[model samples]
Target: MSGPGRFISFEGIDGSGKSTQARRLAAHLEGLGHSVVLTREPGGSPGAEDIRALVLEGEPDRWSPETELLLFTAARRDHLERTIRPALEAGQIVICDRFADSTRMYQGLRRAGLRVLVDQLHDLMIGQEPDLTVLIDMDPETGLARALSRNGGEERFESFGNDLQAKMRAGFLDLAAEFPDRFVTIDGARAMDDVTADVTARVTEWLA
Candidate 1:
């Protein structure tokens, strides 16, 4: 249980249950005697949390994809500087609910040519990737329905509807293919306990 810290990230279309899985993984690791830090993007640190409110609330068009990209990047930078890096340096397992991949899909795929911008800013400002990324795959329609039911005031992205969810699902799968070494895809459209067991098993294997 003593070694270099591991950084784990969870990603999926809205309502894919990545957040729940991420939290479960963190607690599971902690119960196994590993130090764990469970955090989230767009709002991990104080400054980044402030930015999260700005980008994740209001109308769907509250900010253009470009502006949203910038906001996300800025928040990520702050999160890295103030939260992630420090936790990693202290040799704690860092489980993040979402990371740059979310930005790549949500903002990058919203419009053509935006993915290039997403990568550029990511390389320039963040330049960091998690050691492991768990992508929870779920049906777009089902995911959208679940998201809408949340009524989580921060439903800005979910407000975009099923079209975006479908696009994001495909994009996330592509990203998994593109980064096979660190990405693991799991079915999120199952019972929560089933999904949690799969995630725990896969992540435990990685840690081993």
Candidate 2:
């Protein structure tokens, strides 16, 4: 607990292979003898899990943009309080699947300028952010097609139109540009092994 923990987050569109890369990076860290905690936003805490279900499983038409943002924020707040904070304090490297960046992308869909809202909420609720964020970039069509092939059913966000998904991808790229130091852009269009190698190398460098 003496050394500060390293916090890393993986983000992208639903089908962009962020989760797959996140797991591989965590496994690599563990293999390197670092204690690692692999977690996800909106489902990391019990309260957040409930919010996650509501956001993803509730009637799609019933969910407004503000409602969606609020639910995701709620889950994030709980996740930080219950899971993220403690792990970091224990000096564990935490790899998270989806974090504030999702709000930057998805909430940007509803709000004209979502950054301010997300920041204010983070200040009021969740405090710390990841030390590094790995954002995988992929074509919306390809990622969604791959996601659909792997999934049995789609969630509200997963069911977004191609236009929305494209916008979300743009938002992610925009975020990476805006915060070059914190965001590491990885080309997810490459083969799985290649993407995994890229992600692991970044994590290894950052942790070093």
Candidate 3:
């Protein structure tokens, strides 16, 4: 835990294959002799995972937008302290499936004025952003279809339906534009190998 390490996060709607790409990238980097830590937000460290269960389970309206944001931020703080920072200090590339960006889109966009709250909370609590964020861009229809096919209980966000997914897609795109230096937007509709190749190239170039 002494050297500079890379931090990367994958983001997209529920079924945009961001998680798949994150795993693939971790493997690819490891194959190249890099130490990689593959993790996810809302749950990465043990404490965060417990919070994830609370946030992801129960009803969609289980918590107010403000309450949900606080929960996510708390989980994120634990994750950063227990998982991300230490791994980065150890010089291992940390590839997270999701991070604060998901909270920004999920909670921020859920209400009209909540985006400010999400940003303020993040700034006050979780100040780290990924060195590189791979955003898998896909149509909401396609993404939702893919997500629903999985048939999992973690459907709270997915249950928000197509319209919200579409907005989330746009929000992600806006975030990419907002942080051009660190964001890599990739088309997720392509074949798996093709998408992987694109993501690999971007990360490779960044690592160079």
Give TM per candidate. 0.97, 0.93, 0.97
Question: Tens digits of per-residue lDDT for model 2 on 67-120?
Answer: 777888888888887888888888998899999888877876666766677778
Show where candidate 3 strays beyond 4 Å: 1-3
**lDDT (Cα) of model 2:** 0.83
Q: Write the per-residue lDDT of candidate 1 for residues 1-208, one digit (tens) a residue.
A: 2137899999999889889899888889989999999999889999999999999999988899999999999999999998899898899999999999999999998999999999999999898999999999999999898888998899998889888999999999999999999899999989999999999999999899
Better of 2 and 3 by TM-score: 3
User: On residues 11-84, what C-alpha lDDT tens digit does candidate 3 reach at each position?
Assistant: 99989999899999999999999999999988999999999999987778889988999999999999999999
Output the worst ten-in-a-row residue range by lDDT, candidate 3.
1-10
Compared with the true structure, all predictions reach lDDT values of: 0.92, 0.83, 0.92
Global CA lDDT computed for model 3: 0.92
Error of 3 at 16 (Å): 0.4
